[model samples]
Target: MQESSEVAGSIVSEDCLDEVIQEQIKTLKNAQTAALSAVTKRRNEIFRLMDNCDNLHLVKSEVIILCKLRDKYDESFQQYEKHLTDSSERNTVNKRHSENTASIDRFITEMNNWVKESELQLTADLDRKSLCSSSTTRTKSSRTSVRSARLKEKARLAELMAQHAMREKTKVMEEQELRLKQEREEQEFRLRKKKEQLELETKIAMSQARERVYAEADNISDIVPKDTPSPLNPNVDPFQPQPSDITVDTPQLKANVPCSSSHCRFPEPNLDMQLQSQQEMFLKTQQHMTAAMLLPSIEVPKFKGDPIEFATFMMAFDARIAPNASGDADKLYYLDQQLEGEAKDLIGGCLYMSSSEGYTSARSLLSQEYGDPYKVSMAYIKKLISWSALKHEDPHGLYTFALFLIKCRHAMTNLSHMEVLNHLPNLQAVVKKLPTYLQNKWCSLAGHLREEKGGVDFADLVEFVYRKAKAANDPTFSKFALQNNYSKP
Candidate 1:
């Protein structure tokens, strides 16, 4: 019986020891699981903090969050240490447990201080950086505003300067234009004044010229008279009485000579027959040369006792021979007895006698006849012409003889036997002595003779005149005769 009871006690004691060991192992395993979970939670918390603050976003707040996390981890570690120091947990065979606790405690302490210091430094840096950024932004904005104000002021000043310059330039141009217009007006005024002055002077000069012309005309009118005759002919007296000595004497030798032939012979001439024939001939030939008109004879009244009166009475007797002669020879002899000796001699001296009346005379004895009375007047004219050549006479005498012959030709141009033979040579000689201008006068006389006598032998007389003119000493007479040969007689 005793052995059975002891065996049963040993079995029960063994069962109790096995149950306590199982409980202790369960507690240690739970503690280890809690510690591992806390470490994993803390590592996840650190990783989240690091990720949220990568570019320093909210740096101070992030650092503060990290400190709090470190504090939480430290408290959890202390609780783990308390669990480990319990008597039953102390005698347990947990290996390297104190070293693990101490390592966790040191890590928690370093993390807490690092987190506090990081929070403080981060806060100071953030405050200083914010202040520097605000100061830089304010400086930039001030510079931009100042630049805008300066640009506005400069634009206003430039606008004012440009306006002032334009006004000054416009004013100067207007002044210059005004000055130019004034100068132009003054120049025009001067030109107008000068034109008016010149016109006035021209008018004055024209008036003076007209006045001077009138004055000169008046002076010329006063200097020369318009109607005065040339002053030269007061001394000539055509009616003066000729003296008794003016008688032409006849040569007795030629008066008595007998004729050599019938052509040279002439019948004796009585005053009455001679005057009748001459009057008939002169009436027939009066159309030829009429240079002078012979005046009619009248009876002289008896004036007694003055010698000058007697001489005048003789002139009257001589002048009347051609008119008073009659066809009766006895009546002419009685009429010759009535005159004084000087008067009868003067009657005989005449070469060509004039008939005072316009017709032939009648028989007379102290009875008057009317015209040229004798045919022998032509014969006497011929004798007178021949005598002029014999005497070296003056041209005036020959001119007087030519005038007498011209009258004789007018008295006898109708008579068939009537001849003017002696007048030609003397007329030619007188024409030669004359100047060319006087020769033209003789040419007129010769032309008169040709018309009256109808057959006057003037070619010989013209040739004679031409020869004398050529041989003469006068140049004017020679040249005129050479140039006008047909005009000479």
Candidate 2:
């Protein structure tokens, strides 16, 4: 598809260039005709002028002017000729380009036809294979029954484990909730006690001030009772014209009042500072919770601790169908397998996230997804890791397992280098340890990814991979691979 598209584009470009050259040729011809007409008119005028003059001096002067006019016309014609030559060269090049385009188009069309025929043949072969397999199975019904029984047993075990994990998660959540409630109660109690202490201190200070005032009054009575009026009878005798009845009043102290927590006004918090703190806390809490939840994930069973199960499956499936027709059967089978993985990843990733709330959460994500969710989590992680830089930390075997996802061509198209590079610290460590051939293959893949759309639209990390691969001269990327044009966007 890509090669054909490029061939088509080249054809169009050549056509456009030819049209431009044709226009230039037309312009040059017009200019040449104008210059020739001017030259002819100038010669006629000079000749007539010479005839009208009988003097040799006049004739010589006319001839001299005519020579100048002829020279001017010659220069103009020479320039026009040069332009015409340039136009001709352009036309030649355009013609060559058109011929090359026609050849490419022919090749592309033929290749496309071959591909279509190959696909049809492959489909027919697959159908034949299915019939054969079915007939063979009919002959071995006992074996088929045994295999089915084993698969059912495996499924039952898987379901049992999943249920156990869910139960454990529920218990863990209950415990967490209880702890949270206890902490909340403790915090509330502390706040209540602190408020009470503040109110008590206020009351004690107010009582002491009242006592001091009472003591001062008692001392005044003890020292000057004779000069002081009676406590009550002095003010009662309003008819008495006593000078003591006009006694001056002393300054009275105001008592301290306790403030109510319910009505006490608090200064508003600084919006910027408060918001910053909230955001920081929220981020920290979110990360902590996510990490904690993920920690209990169930371990995915491995194929004898092998990390290349998916890769092996795809390659094997490809090989199985490769002989059918131009590898179309293999491509389709692998594509279907790839789609299954993606779908599993979606279902399993979400389930793992849910199960991660407890002991089930702390286990390996890959294991849980494979068993309980029976899905792939890489796709989910890919989206997350792309959006945030934090997904690269401690990318273990499960992280590498996620790479199986790149087989989904469309999914790969949506990713970017920044998202991939963010995981570079981990990827680099893995790449160095990989066999040279595998490393080369990875780099070649990376280069194709980069060049696919005139530079990788997804991730930039692969450019580094491209450089390394180029330096290593990986077999996966030959001269042909580099020169092979891709489909137009």
Candidate 3:
């Protein structure tokens, strides 16, 4: 989508404005018409999806797609409304707008209907199934029946767990996509605002230049008004206009004078003003850059004394400010400003030390307490170990687990103890936290890995879980999986 936007932007110019806008309208209309047809054709399949949905997740996905299509229809309709400038254009736009409005309204009505029906059906099915299962458990308690029931219950739990995990992944991916979309929109908005600001500023600059030129025109004429005295003799009556002076006006104040003194050899006001405006804007931009050095964020982020976080903070501080500092005093001042809580208190004693010694001592103390590789690696590992065993249907917990595992792996690599994590106790402890399906995949993969290498490694486990976590999040994966289970209407 961003690439498409960029392509559209690059192709648009003053000369091609009408062409680009028309293309935008045509493309949007085509997409909306296609979406309307799909929704119309798949009405029954959509109903079936809701009927078989475990909850209302599938219904929500369909509604989001519909809402997006409706919004595009609206945007295109609005653009056409804006495009209409004549009576004939107005009639055409009005007709198209009415048609699109009807489509969008219908789309919204269908979405509302889908939500209402799916919610009621899901509630009824859940209650019915729960009551039926409980009744079956009590009535059919024979040994074979109990065994089958247990198997069925286990499978159902696994299915729910898988669903939960997928939902979490989907949520994370969607949020990421949303953020990207917002950033793009913000960038485009800023670009537009900047262009407008420049144009407005240029117009004002030129207007000022014209005013200055016209003011200077007053002093250009040597011929005085009939009642005004000449500069050489204020008491004398004003000089009468000569034939040449009556016909022409000029300023002889500077070297660049006309041969006939009929006109001042003024530079083109428009060209001069443009160059002045560009120079001024460039200078202001340079001054802002110099003053900010780092902007959007001007200061280094503060840090407390968490060993796991200390390494990142130290690297950032060093990279951003340390190299540019004049001496230890500046460095200490910057460091002192950034530290807080335990980190700040830990370096408090070092402030009494003189000059380089104080800065040196404070830095050393910070390093010993919070930048130790062993301590940092242990902290990362402890976090991994401390994670609660993921509940059977907790997708958010699983996502957090994957994120932390990746962080832990990064810390281990930095600590030069990557192999330490693959030890039997550590490896199995983390594995036991995964859901049943993931455990099964791990077992199968571990067995093959052992056969190939004489022992299994933890990287393989991380990679496997990472892949599953990603797959679970992907909406496309969910869509295809859903489609596989049901034919389209």
Q: Pick the candidate with the highest lDDT.
A: 3
TM-scores for all predictions: 0.22, 0.20, 0.39
Go through the candidates in order and give each one's C-alpha lDDT.
0.52, 0.50, 0.73
- Per-residue CA lDDT of model 1 for 1-489, tens digit only, reads 799989998889988977776666566556665655666566456545544323344444544554565455455544544545366765552444556556556755665565666667778888999998889877888888888898998999899899999989989999999999998687667656755655565556555655665666667556444444445577975567768866888655463565343344334335455445545554444422121122222556432322324434445655765355664353345444555544344344221233322121322211221122333443444454455341232444444544444544544464333344435664465455456654775577667877888644634344444444344424456444465665777
| Candidates ranked, most accurate by TM-score first | 3, 1, 2
Model 3 / residue 210 / CA error / Å: 31
Cα lDDT tens digits for candidate 2, 54-161: 333444454555456545545654554555446776576456535644643464354345445655666787899999888885779788888999999999999999
Task: Give the per-residue lDDT of model 3 (tens digit) for 1-489.
Answer: 999998888777654987777787677557556655655554445556655546468667777776666666566556555654578977876786678568657755876786788688878989999998888767776867879999999999999999999999999999999999999788767766766666577567656766765565555444322333334777988779666545556544755434433333344335456557766775586456444532444457899878888877989889888998999989988899899998999888877778699999998999999888778877777778888888665656677788878777666665875567889988999999999878988899899989999987677778887777776656665444566557756
lDDT of 2 at 116: 55
lDDT for model 3, please.
0.73
Worst 10 residues of 3 by lDDT: 221-230
Whose TM-score is higher: candidate 1's or candidate 3's? 3
- Backbone clashes (count) for model 3: 3
TM-score of 3: 0.39
Q: Global CA lDDT of candidate 2, please?
A: 0.50
